[model samples]
Target chain A: MVFRELSLPVRLLFYLFLIVAAVSILYPLTWMSYTSLKTNEEVMLSPFGLPTRVSFENIAEAWQTGNFTRLYANSLLIAIVSVVGIITISTTAAYGLARYHFNGNRALFLYFLVGMAVPTQALMVPSFKLMAILDSWAAALHLPVPLLNSPLAVILTYMSWSSLAIIFIRAYFMSIPPELEDAARVDGARELQILRHVMVPLAMPAIATMTIFYFVFFWNDFLWPLIYLHKHTLRTIPLGIMHFEGKYVSLWSLQVAALSLAAWPPIFIYVLFHRRIQRGLTEGALKF
Target chain B: MANTSQAGAAIPRMRPSRFRLPPGEAWRENLYGYLFISPWILGFVMFLAGPLLVSLGLMFTEYAGFKKITYVGLANFEELIKFDIRFIGSLRVSAVFAFWTVSLAIIISLAMALLLNQRFKGHTFFRGLFYLPAAVSGVAMTFVWAAMFEKDYGMFNQILRIFDFDRVAWLTSIEWALPSYIIMRLYGVGHYMVIMLAGLQSIPDDLHEAAKVDGANALALFRHVTLPLLSPTIFFLMIVGMIGSLQVFTEGFMLTQGGPARSTLFYVLYLYIVAFTERRFGYASVLAWLLFLIIMGLTLLQFWLARRWVHYESEEA
Candidate 1:
């Protein structure tokens, strides 16, 4: 028999392997989630055992002690604002680059694609210097505050370096039939009117997919925020959780609870939009 | 009624327009095109290009601070080659990590994708479950894994006890620490699985059937037909995976802290320390350039190898 007609024993083994793999992937995460629902005493007593009593108080205390509400607000603000900027900038640029054939169009598209290879860390030292320059520029212009230690600082960096988003969005725009734009133009719609009315609506799915990607990316980001924002109040969720973990080393239950709380938002989104996110991820990467 | 009707009337604007967009393709198309991408161009020039050039310059110099940047022609690179033991060791660690992680991730992902491609019960659920690790926050995931890899109370050790194996110090033992990271990386195979699945599904099913008709067994079919078609996808994953795994920071940073004996000190992590902790931006820039060259070399090498291995269907036709 051909290997295509697998015997029962082999197929059973395949199922077993898949089960083992799935369990290996999920058990630890579920264990951590379960650990969060238990008391500190319970966790100390039995690390592997299920909670004797479900405790809501652990999560509550974690929220209060970690200042997660404040951190959440900060993270939500940063993620939303940055994603907004990313969507706007990425969509416009993607639309323009994908549709309009200006001179050096291919070169400009190549420019963004090639930028993807330059590791973000390569720009660190210089980015620090550039931020300093911007800070002084802000100061000299008599701005309310220096630009370095603010959400805007991170937003500007994210917006400028959203190459992946641009690639995906541009692909989406390219996939769109230019016939729609032509039809709109024939009806007295200007270029702005065409983009705003037609292309934007057509490319919403890719745009939304990119929004989720960027939002989660910014939400989970540590390095930039770590280097830039020093103020305790300005700390994003990851920073706050890091600090919380450091300070409350023995509070494993509370830390786990905090982590679960922090983990939920992104996981929730990923679970909901697994298909779209996965598809978009592959489309961009597979373009090469 | 007349007064009300008169009140409803509003005046029209006198000005034709405040701003005219230069009245041509310069305004409409080319201008907007440049306008749209102006941010990226500016960012490329200021952030990417400037830093890249500055880093190149600083490779031969010592940039202590802005004003303290002294010209030290090739001293940084020479010192690194001659003296920096940690630098050499970190490179070794990064290479090993990248070599194992990328290959293993790709291989396992392909296996899982093949399994997932089968028509079976609850495969979708299993697929999503596998991808769960990638969805979780890096810091939080590390912490959970940190907890799981605990010597005394960790999940893996607990499983070892159940199987009558000795509870191994997964993260503490010098021998097991790197392996522990590899294990941690395995859980996220779901990501590459998704990509590979897409590629697998894109291959027409009739090709497999046709190969079978020609007396090609399943293994032979996969070898001659499926493998060649999948090569492009695998190559893509390897390039991305190599670049990413080389710069792995969040994992090693949180879990091992490049632990037991600088065993896990990644190249980027080392660069981070030199730049931030030690404030050796000049030396850091040298490391960055070295990193760039290494990645570029490997990527070019892969492209060269792809000429031998990767078979695009388009090229075949």
Candidate 2:
């Protein structure tokens, strides 16, 4: 039976269940924020209790001591650079795959699609070795930064892992009618111009999804940074927050505040474009 | 390949004068395609395929970091299969964690999808609210759970103390650590729920209406129509969830560090320890390949099982 046709009690039960689900998801976040404002003594006395006063003391302390400003800058730089590179590479490749009639086009598309199933975890050892090898090569060529412990290592890793982006944008491009591109071609427009003018504006929605998806992916990435970025000055948000917890083992308020800072970007992004993010999740999964 | 060739054949018919063009047209098209995809091909080779081949070779040889390498044919596999207690323990830990987490995620997320699928006011708000956790960064999410599961002053213990129960060591005790890890991982299943909700929406309303018109009750309608239709989504979630669960690292690394007694030594965490901390790159390569094969096997097995239960509309008579 349709939900509207259900008995009153059944409908009420569904509402109750949904309410509980929402609370379970949201309460931890609210609890975290409020607890960050509490004093350590207050937290010890009543761990589950609300803050007595709205205090900026803990957040301020954590920000300075945890080195969050530097971490945020590093994280933002890496995620932004990697995302720009990924989009540029994937969209150009996806357009070609979607619209071209070349030999082995199908083979090339499948080749990328297969990379999606290979987990990054499985490549850790060899990736480390590869980075070491690249470091020597860079040093021989007298490049500025070594690939071993620099941010470049993680950024390059992030950029290289764009199979999903290629696949997603290719599907979106394929959905666009070929007639639009044909029309542009008939006007004597070059392929790049048509891609820039005709295809991109129409593909903004899919691009937006990819931006959110990869931005969050690179931002929250832990293992690669944990491996490649050993220098404290180059630490990203996830690495910084992790070491924050280790440093402030006994200071609950500071730890909570640091975590709250780390959570803000993703939460802010979610609050802003949650509708697209949610739809994107389903579209990626269902379409795959 | 045949379908793609057919599509390619359609291009010539669309442009009648294309046959009069020089042979360089096809060559130019091929060059353009190759140019566009060259970056991906370079990345795939250097980052993925090259590493894969190197790791495959390393799986047999005894190669430590920059140290002289020795050819130890079949020895790593023999040790892992026979004498490595820690490796076996890690496999068991990963299996138990995957089993419980995937099963619970499917049940909880499916129930959530079913609940929100019904028409109700504020359903959209609730969907966003429920999914908000999945959007939180993993490290941030882990810290929040760490605070909640803290022993002396954490939220769970504080609430338990209100009822005068003793504080349980959530991340410390051996028996409790894995369960705590599972609980923390389950907090991020909101994305899975959204996927299931999408699946539910795709099922035609006419099917439900037709079932009701046949004098079916709510349970019968759900049983006969909803279950079959949603099986494919469930199957998808099951395989994806299991694969992710088997490779879980952040929570274990952050919250427990696979400690108190290695009760939470997830497979990936152990691999990290072996590869990085212990500097046994060759041995870790063996572990990495094993994990990959395990995931591949489970995925293939799930796909094989799905043929019996997963109902696709295209397969219907």
Candidate 3:
């Protein structure tokens, strides 16, 4: 619709720019995927050429050697737990702020807003110390695993960093009319029931947005995982890929395969819900 | 924009006023409210506010992880400013990276957003294709870029070789190392573009019709109409992008490790090295605080400057 207003030359220029942008982004990813199928000799000898014969050997080898199964398991575990934790925690808070006229509601909302600006790096050192203390507490309780090197550490960290999520869901909840709740109240539904039946279902779009965003964040996050997860078994995909890169420094095909392994899961998610992801990100960003 | 209202304003007219509630009813409502929000409050206190205070306290002390803590009155800051040339270098690297990346991302992403916003063929496909890289793991994307930036037989060098140009030492050279990272990082600007695209689509068509009826050209339409409308999104991207770039770690950490004379020693990377590798927790805390302060200052500055250029629709009478 907007393009119809532009002159022919300007329209042509815009198309040119779009095509270039698309190619610039796509070419690299294509190269990485195809190169993952090539042998090291093939990669070195014909840098621009396609693989002599398409093969999954490099991917299999990298997956086995890189312990990617464990990495995928770990990453998926963290992402699921973190997204669920963040969404539930934030949505509940947002519902409270949006629905209630209680004392300190605004103050608590502002507190979360302020937390959003505090960089994660600022809290790293103390977080490590706090986790150590928590680890000792867990040990005293005879828990099976330590929080420091386990997925639980990152999950707990992820749950706490949902200020944006709170603000977002609150904005979402406020847009929801009070009549729905009032009607539910008139029907003798409890507050929690009203929330579960009315509010949550109404806010599924926003929740899904938060879920996708937080899932992507947890999956791709490098810094916290690097700091918290020291054990090889606990490594997530990004950390695992970095470790794989270090160990197989000279194996080009294996490295590409490993990188591809790390990239594919999130890419698959994006492809499936590209429209929702795009719309949600923009809406969420504007809210922020 | 609708959600920017305060708590009282956000409350619906159907709800009874706070003063009208009976004591028992008010108490019950408060109980329910607190019960609902307890999760976030708990999280904030446990994971954020508590650690923040601890970090602030640690900033004023000298202690390794295993050693007894001792008071150090701004000694870490003193050393950072008065000595520690590498600290200065890291700040410079971070500043340059932030400056270039934030500006370049704004320009490129906005342009792409505008282009994708047009009713063209394959626009949705293009939008997703562009934004696809932003969805990939940063470590993985960095590896692909690292391969492409390899000195010999890399994709970039092969193209250059075909064109009879000399192979550029993309990652190894001190000058190129930072820019290469910037280039690699720009691949993920698709998120910002999508945000901008949404901003563009939200712009009312009648407003453009009015502008065009007044004999405005394309440049004038963009300058007088589109830019002011999009300024809020631009301002947002600027602040968030700057904050992100200033605290950049993964690219430098994964690829360079702050090598080639620490040319790409991002501020966070250096702080990580200091705290984790060198066991200078106290000094690293100081570095972290300074970065926090710097980011806070820059963010405030952007807000101040945004008052001049960031036009919100709500401001219209």
Candidate 4:
């Protein structure tokens, strides 16, 4: 066969390459899940073997022992609240940047874009110190709940760090046809009305994409949560599992099960909505 | 800032604005624009700008564990250069890790992207499988990798036994720890691959078809057509990948603690220990500044080099 056409052997080679790639990707994940189900004796005997039985016992034990039920509630609230906050903030900002032609708009767009580069490590100390000060200030002011170990700290941190979503959704808004907006304008639709009725529907794909990205990011994030979340009750899944593993390092099955439990939510979300996720990731990567 | 605001005020009055709404309508539009973007600006001022300024101020002072602060005036940086052996060691480790992992990850990502860009059965499933690692919990990924690299009774060593090879301490030994982590880090390549796939899709098929009709082989086609076309994407990934790998922290934080004779110590991990563990906020600010400077220098250097090689669609005929 010629260069443009694939021959049998070459096609088979491509298939083989894909199989190898897939295995490399899926192996460690399956390894974790399988190891979680295996007994300690079985694990020591054969680390790579499939579990002899498919049991819910490990899942149940990890949930109860790790206090994942409460952690899950806390993590879910933080993630959901953070995503909503990010979307609302970013959508407004992105809509302005993408649709409006005001003065210094480009400069403003670039300003928000700087969020992608401001390393969290650099902000770690200052944010911790700021939140502590805020907590005390709130306490002195007789505020209901202080900001230090509260979910507001995590949510605010995430919202400020959401310039990536702004960039993403802006690109999406930029892609929509200008004629659609013009048509709505001709019909005497106000700006807010056009945004709500016309533009929002057109931008749903992009919004859905950002929704998935922000959800996963907020859910899976470790460093910020570790720094800000001090209370045992406020601990997220990763934090709880981390401390649990430290205490029970010798309990292989429980530790593995906890890790599996910690990894599941995002993985489940990713699998269910991979098409949108892939689209979002690709566009973000391409645009950047 | 004042000048820019004045200029912003001046621009609309002399507008080439063909579809001019009334003055009141125009004023309202500007107000709405400002209102819409207000949240980000407010957040940036409160969270980012304020903290950034505080961090810069912290770099000059000596503050330990939220106690009394004393101004030190660049002494932290001076100590980093003159007396901090662990800091320098971690820098070396991070540089090495970034070099090997970023380049290898880029290549692996490109290769997978090329493979996935082809039309095949189960393409979406394969792509999804490859992209799996990006969504995984960082702590969970670290723990699983820690298990996989266990010295004894690990999956890898069990495989090595088949080839009559002795087991190696993947994460525990100095020689193997960095490289083992590099392998684990390769799992992140799928993310970059998806980016590459996006870039590849943007390249028109006719270019490849023309190259093929010109009697170009697959290798030649990739070299002349695909490589040049994908250069910008490659350059983008290079900058992002380098910046990311340079700030590597999670592995050492969650798994290694920069052990095995400090072979696994990363720049941020060491900084984290200073700030959070030792509670030296001022010194950690110094570390943050150094990391920022190193990243800035490298990013500038990449941009300079990119002028020599990166191809842009707009630059050509």
Give candidate 2's whole-model lDDT.
Answer: 0.83
Give the CA lDDT, 0 to 100, for residue B133 in model 4.
92
Residue B22, candidate 1: alpha-carbon lDDT: 28
First chain TM-score for all predictions: 0.94, 0.96, 0.94, 0.91
lDDT of 2 by residue, A1-288 (tens): 457888999888877877776776788899988888888788778777888788888889999999888999999999999999989888888877876666777777766665776778999999989999999998999988789888888888888888889978887887777778777766677777888999988989999999999998888989999999888999999999998899878787888899999998889999999999998898777666
Point out the higher-scoring one by DockQ: 2 or 4: 2
User: Tens digits of per-residue lDDT for model 3 on B1-317?
Assistant: 22312233222222423343444455656877899999888988999889888888887788788748999988987898799998989999999999999999999998888777778888888888988988884889888898889888678888889999998999899989999989887888997899889888889999999999999998999999999998888888988899989888988898889988899999999999999999778888888888878787766666566566545432221
Winner of 1 and 3 under lDDT: 3
* Candidates ranked, most accurate by TM-score first: 2, 3, 4, 1
Give TM-score, chain B, model 1: 0.83
lDDT of 4 by residue, A122-175 (tens): 788998899888889989999987787888898887888768888878777776
Error of 2 at A34 (Å): 1.2
- Per-residue accuracy of model 1 over B32-108 as CA lDDT, tens digit each: 57777776677667767777887888787777656777889889988899999999999999889888988999989
User: Residues B197-286, candidate 4, lDDT per residue (tens digit)?
Assistant: 888888999998998889999899999999999988888788888898887887788888998899999999999999999988999998
- Native-vs-model 3 lDDT? 0.83
Query: What C-alpha lDDT, on a 0 to 100 scale, does residue A190 get in candidate 4?
Result: 73
TM-score for all predictions?
A: 0.90, 0.93, 0.92, 0.91
Better of 1 and 4 by DockQ: 4
Interface RMSD of 3: 3.1
RMSD of each: 7.8, 3.7, 3.9, 4.5
Residue B23, model 1, lDDT: 28
What is the per-candidate TM-score for chain B? Answer: 0.83, 0.87, 0.88, 0.86
Error of 1 at B101 (Å): 1.0
**Candidate 1 vs candidate 2, TM-score winner:** 2
Candidate 4 regions with alpha-carbon error over 4 angstroms? A1-5, A39-41, A182-190, B1-26, B296-317
